[model samples]
Target: MDAHFARVLADEQDDAPTPGASAAPPASSSRAAPTAALSQQQLDALVARADAQELDQLDARSLRTLVQALERRVRSNALARAKHADAPERFLESELALHSELARWRHVAAAPAALLPELAALNAAPLLLGLFAHDNADIRLDVLALLAELTDAEDDLADADALAARRVWVRALLEHRLLPLVVTSLEQLDSAPGVEDQDEEAAGVYHALQILENVADLEPPACAQLCATTVVLRQLLRQVAAARRFSANKLYASEVLSILLQSGAAPRAHFMAGTVATGTATAPRDDSDSSKRRKQAGAGDLLDRLLQAIAPYRKRNPASEDEEELVENLVNALCSVLLLPAAQMHFRRLEGLELALRCLKDRAQYVFSGALRMLDLALMGDARNCARLVEVGGLKALFAVFMGKKKAKKPTATATATTTRRAKSEAKAKEEELTMSILSSLCALLSPAAAHDVFDRFHAKFVENDMEKLDRVVDVFVKYLGRVEQRDLAGDDDSDDDDDNDEKDENEDARYLRRLDAGLFTLQRATHVLAHLCASSRKLRAYVLVKLHEHRIDMDVLAQILKEQLAMLRGGDSDSDGDGDGDKDVTDTDGERAKMQAQRTLLVHLLSTLQAPTSDAASSAVEPKQEEAKHET
Candidate 1:
């Protein structure tokens, strides 16, 4: 009932009963009067002195009691630390106990889900979160580590109930303005890059970021709040922009930034508005260059800030794998934001197209892929960018990548698992980046040129070099179609179900997705580039037709692609008799539906243009699907 203790006795009365526990208490002592909740200090002393075996054997009610007691002890010691700020000896013992009590909360992570909600009820979040400002750095760091442990998602992944408990704790932490405090601690910690011997502070910063990530995982709104409501995004941007050397925190800051931007439009619009000063967590007054950047960051273009942050590696080589990953993360985040029209405008104004082209041409392995991705997203639906791409020889750079895939180092026969995975991953990124860059070129170039730059010059590039680019595009189309056919064939090598039919169905669905990932998406993009080319230049179409006839590729594959696209376009309403949402980004899917309507229409027209197939295989492929499409429509 008093402030010195959390009341756990009455709180547990309504909790869902623990697994295997009875619904009611024994009748032996029912006549005796109910006991009042013990004070926090008394409960702590009792729990601490109890045998370890007795503690281990605690039932649900006892576990709830222990959680409240820890909350009380932590709160009291926190107050003691604050009161004795000028007198260290007076609070030394209290700080020590406070650390122990914080560690003690880890026990609750192992308890039944029924007891976890009591943390919110006991108001433990405020007391634990407030310690980030405690004068003792170790104590503050302990809190960060403790918060990360308590909210570890792996522990809560067993089922729905376990996950619900994690959400409760995360929401409670955010409810107490935890984001602002975490940002403040990051500012205070000596986490700046190039600092020597920052092992402790680095760990603190890592734990801080890990905590933020965990909180964001359980409470999605925390990400938006970090961007718009708190200065956390500014801190993260500061970390990213301040990198002079590779640090885990800097890499982590980039990862966290990517997560925030991808989370929703709030962060995209936050930086797309070109400022980080709007967050409420204002930094303390300082005049160092870094500090000045922080101060200027409030009004500076954050996209520019991000650009400068990444600009170093544009020419300079990365010293390590971590550095490469950091660059990729920043690039990914930038691309995510560029999905917005406003961001694309800023990207164009900043000459981002030229910079991306240079990076692409640099031919640096991981960074090369990143640069290509940057161009892919930046050029989407932006004619100014496309024109610049032409002016700056961007076509030469993209076409170079399109004509030849970026190569990853091959693993040796004795390669480790890590090496093998890295090789495969790099290869995958190379394929994806090349495919997308090609798609972007075709899409932007073939569309109507900008009113301000009315030179539909994309068609001209394909015609140059004796139709070399067009020929390469046809090769890519054939290559991806072969991959799709191979994977689809693998999917059809079915076994009789020795197990449940549901498992077989699940496997079929998963195989379908793997097929899409393997080459179906790339195949679709290739189809689009070819279709757009066909529609744009008669010579380009004729060149493509000749190349296909030479490859002897079945023309029915084009018809099959059309059917697949139609399915994806109608996928959002697989069971629908109603109109679907107009937002293509949300409704479009990878499989069980078509990915691109334009690709579908182009395939239909292209197939019509090839009405007289030179082979029966091509002829038979188009006819059945064409007939089915008519019925489906």
Candidate 2:
């Protein structure tokens, strides 16, 4: 008897495809020939016996032989009759007998390890998708648990047959007909705190993500079939929302949502977004005014929920990470909406935009860049929106960020040469580069009058004794001026060359330059505001003068300083760069120490005695003419 059982099992094992082997045939077709021979009554009898928990009572060798036979039937699909074929009661009995025995086998702690693989193979085979839809919860959970194990096995990803079998089981699990039961199971798994240990719960979450990952790979039609059920969508959203607060579970929720979005479930995403938004609006906050407290708390709660939804996306993995990167793709799509004009309007009224911006501010560098790219898209061809960015203090905030170092320092090494290392030096260079980008954005939204107001509001903060921060702010100012000058230079160069080009090319280039110049001029105006602090604020005047005198100012930046000092000297009248003639009293001191001391004296004296030029009749007379020309256009 042992020899006979060994021979049978050996043959089946030999036939088992290597982990990387070609796809196996679907189990139903392969197993159908054997199942056709059994009757329904016989199957029912086996189920009764199995449910009666009689598996261990069978002779151990006999049980092993039965398991081998059942595995062969399951893997070959011999346990199920062909579609629309007359399924005999006996064949049904045989399949049920296999299922019942496997279900009861879980009670046997000493069951052979091979028994698990055999049972898992059966569950993941094509024949059991329908069987798991059986009304018995224990049966369904047992089947699902086994299938989840198979997905983690090597053969699952490599063998098309195994993947196909698993796919069918997943479909059955998520199908509308079985959604309620599956949802209940998911809910229990999620809510029952101690039912699963940390590792098991983590595995369960990973399993759920894997299922979504698999479903996402299917065609749109197949995806629609799975996602079309409202119950499935709502359940997924609720699970994700609830899971978002738990940092450990957040990644799983993120994975699921990513799959849903990538599967072309746009409405579902929008629906989830709406729920997140509404929830944020109604959540309560900690406050003394009961009404205000309720409102803020509700908003805070809602915001926390949204943060979870978006947090996983706050970091980027490389492009080769997955077939469909749900996190990156969803973030891209949602950013489009959030940065829209309509959304921006609401963003100001609620915490959504603020949260998004904060994430951009504090998140991984690539994420920050991506978020800014989205903002760039929102502002493109929309000058008013660009202006609105300035109104919300975006310029100052972005300038501060641009000057921040990319790599953080170790606290213990702060006092060493670590602060002055080459990495820090290079980072400073990069900081200047990013500072210009922020300036470019602000320049596109030029409002000379508003720039002045913004500068005054931040003047005190900018003039504080923190030299590092002050220098960073100054660096941003210089870069802003550079952007403006570059635009001006580009415009002049284009004008001279436009006549030599074809009319169409000339027109296009001319338009581009105009757009660029507008942006640059906006930056120019903002710099002018900062320049005002050089004379209008006494402490700032002294600080700037000291910096000006110091040898630390790079030569490339001296030109902007010269322009600013000239403007201050001229009583706030804007000075064109060409006016830097040798006639001015300005003198370059050669020694670094002497120059620094001289600059300090110059700035302090200038601030103390500075005065705005009177509005002479000639200048007052020209204002209306410029206004008239602007209005005419």
Candidate 3:
């Protein structure tokens, strides 16, 4: 602006007014070019060009000076507004100048390191964050736009100086309460009329979400900070966990909410506890009105509201890709919270199991996978949930899906590179997920309990229809077992494969083994399911032995197969990179090996259930009554 004034002053001519005849000067003589009062559009365009040009001419020192100048203009105009409220003439012009001056900083985005440290040193974050509440919506939005660009992540950037600079800048912003201001801007723009059309291309809500995601992604600490107060969580819940009209912003909020929940257990606990504190106690949010309305309209914790939002997809699949992804985000967020026992209890209280079962039954291509994941997480180790699952008749859907056709395994020539392989890998992953989910559900349902009849209804499924359910489960176990055996027995004909397995690198060896043994987990879970059924009921135990006999699988053979699995698991541990943490990969492989050991233990106990009578296959089918009587005698 000083340069513009200087140019205007330089162009002025000191022509004497004595030439009155020429005072009118043929009505066309130009004394000097007028300083054009730029419209907001022209001003914005001018600022856009100036941003690039000015920054190009600036060195580190010059950039810092430019920031200080903009800061002065902002504060000066703000002071004018406060002092001269009745006089628009005094403040209005400076307001536009400040808006333009702020607009020029956007070019710093391309190289934010120098500018951010400078801003922190100058204490410019409060001024910048304070602009969020300015009377002019465009000014508030420009603040967001600038912040969004400045905070944009440089994913490939590894400059030590830049990282340290960003850390300081972020700290400064948070110190002045950046998040609450952002939420206010978010609600204002989201609810404000005609703000979006100011630039049909730049969506304010999208910008707000991008700002959040970029910050959270660049710094894990930011994720905790974002969720520390309930304002962010509550606003995000309002966006995702309610029946709000759908938009891309809804999907984005859902994604950020998931990150927050998964960041640490504190956020998850807060969500489950429905604790809505502001900072340490309460935050001043723009959505306070909507918050109360939401509490009234939707009762229960955040988990329950998530269920309500997610419930629609069970019967009707997402109508569009955005909606599908949105629901996926909600389900993902719910899954993260479900890791807490309190969340699981809340979920079961809300009858969330029934909803998941319905979704599994709907098998709508879009809804089934997400619902299966949520259900898988929900019933993992919770007996009450599994009991509710059984009570709600979830078993039928699990069996129906379990009985679905097995994918064909055929040898094929390796193909040229294309998307088909990626698609196949995805499909294969989904298949594994579905199989594991049902396996888990069954294991949870038929688990041992103090009351004999607790699992009798579940046990009876194996005995009804000539033991159809049990036969199918065994077939699944056999099928997965066959896959494992075929691959293991093939014995690495590929020289590369053998080399990879011999490599001490855990990742490489695991990848090689994973490709060969895709059936391992399905096999483990199937083994667990069968083991539970055998141990839970003597009548079911007799049927299991007969089925194994019919399939030519003797007790010794079953034990041998299970032992081979254990050996594979144990041997994998031996291949760990000798990180001194073990030739053990103790953290990663311990749980899996332990699970396999437990599976083997179950098989061993099942094998020991009846030692005296396996010689006659026909007589192996004995009654619970006869077995009990013998025990009594």
Tell me, by lDDT, which candidate is best.
1
lDDT of 2 by residue, 507-545 (tens): 755755574444543344334434444434445545665
Task: Report backbone clashes per prediction.
Answer: 5, 28, 4
Residues forming the 10-long window of minimal summed lDDT in candidate 1:
624-633
Q: TM-score for candidate 3, please give it.
A: 0.73
Residue pair clashes in candidate 3: 22-25, 278-281, 278-282, 278-283
Q: Model 3, range 93-170, lDDT digits (tens) per residue?
A: 466567667756766666657567777877778778877767766566667778878777574277777777787787
Q: All predictions: root-mean-square deviation over Cα?
A: 13.2, 18.9, 10.3
Tell me the spans in candidate 3 whose CA falls farther than 4 Å from its real position: 1-51, 112-115, 154-168, 187-202, 275-300, 405-454, 485-502, 505-517, 537-633
Clashes of 1: 5
How far residue 167's Cα lies from its native spot in candidate 3, in Å, is 4.4
* Candidate 1 clashing pairs, residues 3+ apart or interchain: 565-594, 567-593, 567-594, 568-593, 568-594
Q: How many angstroms is residue 533 displaced in model 1 relative to the true structure, after the best TM-score fit?
A: 2.4
Q: For this target, which candidate reaches the highest TM-score against the unseen true structure?
A: 3
Which of the two, 2 or 3, has more lDDT? 3
